[model samples]
Target: MTAGEDISVRRKKLRYRAWHRGTREMDLVLGPFADAHVESYDHAALDRLEALMSEEDPPLLKWVMGQETPPDNVDLAFLELVIADHHARLAK
Candidate 1:
């Protein structure tokens, strides 16, 4: 969090970033995921979401879409949750 930036503001910014990831595919996947989860996120969860958002669109999209494995440095557990959430949404 930035100096004096409220948690709610941070979450709102995260949601905006998730929905505007410079790729339509990323936007579609992450936007809804953020909508469903971001509000309830604690600081650590928000940081994880921010970290995922920091990646470049191409590789991030591939990872999220299950077309490529994310790097060892990436957060696999969180990524799995994202993938699972996306799949769950698709099944709905």
Candidate 2:
């Protein structure tokens, strides 16, 4: 499938599962990360994440959920944290 098609399919699946609505601010910070490297596993998500990361330093989860920017290097790490948290929540 084309990139557009792939994005559409993935977006639909994510939305359907309510995956994008992350239960916490940290989850929100990590949602893009998991979406990039884990769940839907799209490289484009990673690219977008990389771009986001490059913009600023790490912010609090609250800030992230509030749409505050994060530093470039921390984006992946941030997402990893969120993904792990998400899994832990699921396991509970």
Candidate 3:
């Protein structure tokens, strides 16, 4: 994206990517989360999420589903936030 690009455009792009992930499981996991939070996220959070999105779907599914933990080198705080939010929605 152009340096002139700002949050709104970046957010829209994020939402689009989340919804269009090649796997249906990924789309379901990420699309709603992005819709709910991307617009409100700080640049640093967005940067983290964007980096996360570059990862393959299988590992993300494992992490989000709690079948496997995120790696030690990865950031956990934000991932926990997302996983907790996802689980909360499921509980509702």
Among these predictions, the greatest TM-score belongs to 1
Off by over 4 Å in 3: 1-5
Which prediction has more favorable lDDT, 1 or 3?
1
Better of 1 and 2 by TM-score: 1
Which portions of model 1 miss their true places by more than 4 Å?
1-5
| Tens digit of per-residue lDDT, candidate 2, span 1-92 | 99878776665554333333435544344554445554454666645544443332335453444455444555565555554665565566
Q: Report the Cα lDDT for residue 77, model 1.
A: 89
List runs of model 2 lying over 4 Å from the truth.
Answer: 1-39, 58-62, 65-92
On a 0 to 1 TM-score scale, where does candidate 3 land against the true structure? Answer: 0.86
TM-score (all chains, Cα) for each model: 0.91, 0.27, 0.86
List the global CA lDDT of all models.
0.89, 0.50, 0.85
Instruction: For candidate 1, report its TM-score.
Output: 0.91
lDDT of 3: 0.85
Best by lDDT: 1
Per-residue error at 16 for model 2, in Å? 29
Q: Sort by TM-score, best first: what order?
A: 1, 3, 2
Ranking by lDDT: 1, 3, 2
Candidate 3 residue-wise lDDT at 71: 86
Q: What is the C-alpha lDDT profile of model 3 across 37-73, one tens digit per residue?
A: 9988878989988977887899988999989988886
